[model samples]
Target: MRISRRQFGTLATASAAGLMVPGLAQAQSATGMHSFAAPAPGKNTHPLLAKRDQNAILARIQGLMKRDGVGALVIVKPENVAYSTGYVSRFAYGPGVPAGSQAAAVIPASGNAQLFINLMESDDAPRMTDDVDVTAMPGFVFVDDGTPESRQERSATIDPLAGFKDALAAAQDMASDGKIGIEKGSLLAGLLAYLNSQVPEDRSLNSEDLLYEARLIKTPWEIDILRMAAQHAERMMSRVAQQLEPGMNALVLENMIRAAGWAEDKEYSMSNMAFQIGIGPYWGVSGSNRNYEIKQGDLMRIDGGGTHFGYISDITRTWAVGGSPTSKHEEIYDALYAGFLKGLELLKPGVKMSEMYAEVRAEVEKSPLLPTYARGHVGHSISLSPLLEDHPLFAPGFDVEFEPGMCVSLETSYMAAEGSYAPGPYNIEDSFVITESGYDRFTTVPDSLVWDGSLTTQ
Candidate 1:
């Protein structure tokens, strides 16, 4: 459905107009400042898929498809499909990423491509991609006897999996014995079972590595949008600072912080934009419940982002609500800052992604209060999804090297409590990218938590 410009404006940041009181409980009037214009919408005018980086993607897929000797590549992963076709599917999330019967854009050895989608999605799927040609097939359609004998008719109806099954059947009908590459991770169990059950003896089915490999590097346009996302996030951080105070509900604070992001006018159409807010001791993670009442000495963590064009932007900041932070609070905050700087110092093109993670880990270990629990990995690569490089080089799992265009999350977590040896953990995550010398931080939140010292009298 086309969201009216007015509706889109509300969803964007246009709603955050005037300055309001600092704390949620009090009814103090805010002084209008030249700075608070409520963020304008973003300026990204195009969709990521509209750019059609398909040739590069196709080249990457060719090797995998050829290695598997697959004639047709049937992709079902939402991120995979978006990467391949620039078609971000909102439907993918509705039924969960894996369970949906979303069909892949069919890439044959030499003919045109076709996209198969569910009957319900027949209308919505076409708008997803501006580049590739698309066709919709219902679960099944049949021809009944008509008054005229000379004309043979065609009818079709679709099952949930009809889109995927039809694409496969079509492929097989054209080339019976050719290999079909299926993204095993994406194919639902039921769909896999059906494919296994119905496949003819002549055809060979196997999993292929086409989509995963293409996601490793991002295009220039993708990088540009990610940068724009960071800019919006930085603006959101400032908005949160103005609203930081004691007594604000977690949800209210979160909604306000996100509203600040929407305040900026978007130049392009953003796809899959997301925002998160965590108050109190938890700075980075939002599982701490929405709108937890802001308490004295509580640190407020506001994280938010909107896509640049279609490239995702994810960034975060932590603020000290009410007055100036205590000495101990400052120490804990400083420790995180140090860790962030350490990570950034090591983040650069040609540097091993693991080396940067190790630097952060080493710095954290040097602190007087050694963490009992394993601190999660420092950062990750993100292009399609917000957290692409979640695993650190030092951590077990994927170890991807840094390249020029890849974006990353430089996050730090630490725990501190007054009078107690075991301090609760506080985390702050921000978006950054590898540069020639080191890296550039996208978030503009104050590196140190600001406490205004004393309360103001009216």
Candidate 2:
């Protein structure tokens, strides 16, 4: 387990190279498309080989299946497919691909799982993991290399419909009389019809809720990835904050945030959508605008983050534009920060989410500067989904208890009304993983409200 840095680097390089499909580069070049780059290794570890525990994940899935009386799960959603089989397909994630052409994972409660993918990804699918068997369906006709093995592979490709039927049959055989759970929302109409013809409607179940339940608890590997994601977001925000000056609009700042991600070979997941830049009276509106220029004495608010290997980071920081924050700014920020700190203190295991929300709300109300401040929720869970927030929100009436291995975000935000004192949004948010005792914070940026223009671009 104690691998030297040089050995780890070699192993990481080999793992990256192993994920390339045969003739992929040539195919990309012939089609005038850029070749996809392998995900960059984390700063301190090989994320996949060193941290990802495929066995642990599968065990958790099977345990949940048993508890739900689901004998088998047919996963068609791209995220669930990757979670089950470790095969992250580019075509599956892209919008141009037809519904039936994307990859799927069939996992039984007590046996080996199967990954059904298009023929083009056959080479890379097996390299993703040895825990599941790969079944390549008919799609993506490749030029024959004339090798015996290549010829055999091409000859073995069957009709796509037939392939789907065979996979369903295999699942039924493995499960016997047990109920089959399928991600009904992600299946194509034709595929669903075919499945209906094979399995009785009474025996079929929608697996969406079960899948979400499985993902609610973060594995150690997932926590590590989320930690790295938060670190990247903090670094990106710091870089963006340094370049903040008068006359710069929201669009320019948004692009700088994206550029920071690209510079580190990371994908900008939130991009322009979840990125909120508020100035003046537009405090509650989300997204960036080209016309909103930063002015001295304007309280600037930024709330966003990026992804690292599919896991997301959601952090918010607000500060002055070019000079010291006004007294009103200090008053509001101090109130919100107090709520944020109280939330952090209550983030330990066994605390109910609703109790935390109530406590944080009471703490914020204690501040005379904003006694009437209110919010629906202080924060929510964070994970692989691009939608950002996940289940068990820190809101009223949510009675879910905090558990170890759950990744969450805690925030204190106030969007002032137009013409109110220091009319703008004020926010302080960070990501954390609930631990055995308390929680470990992922974001490290200073929560100070003053922006003195002291930061320099890296």
**TM, every model:** 0.73, 0.78
Residue 97 accuracy (lDDT) in model 2 = 50
lDDT digits (tens) for residues 224-260 of candidate 1: 6667677766665665565555765564554454444
The superposed Cα distance between candidate 2 and the true structure at residue 248, in angstroms, equals: 2.2
Report the number of the highest-TM-score candidate: 2
C-alpha root-mean-square deviation, candidate 2: 9.2
Per-residue alpha-carbon lDDT of model 2 for 27-98, expressed as tens digits? 321324434445545222223533567778888899999998988888877777777766666777776554
Cα error, candidate 1, residue 184 (Å)? 1.3
Model 1 alpha-carbon miss at residue 339, Å? 2.1
Candidate lDDT (C-alpha), each: 0.57, 0.71
lDDT of 1 at 246: 76
Query: Number of clashing residue pairs in every model?
Result: 46, 0
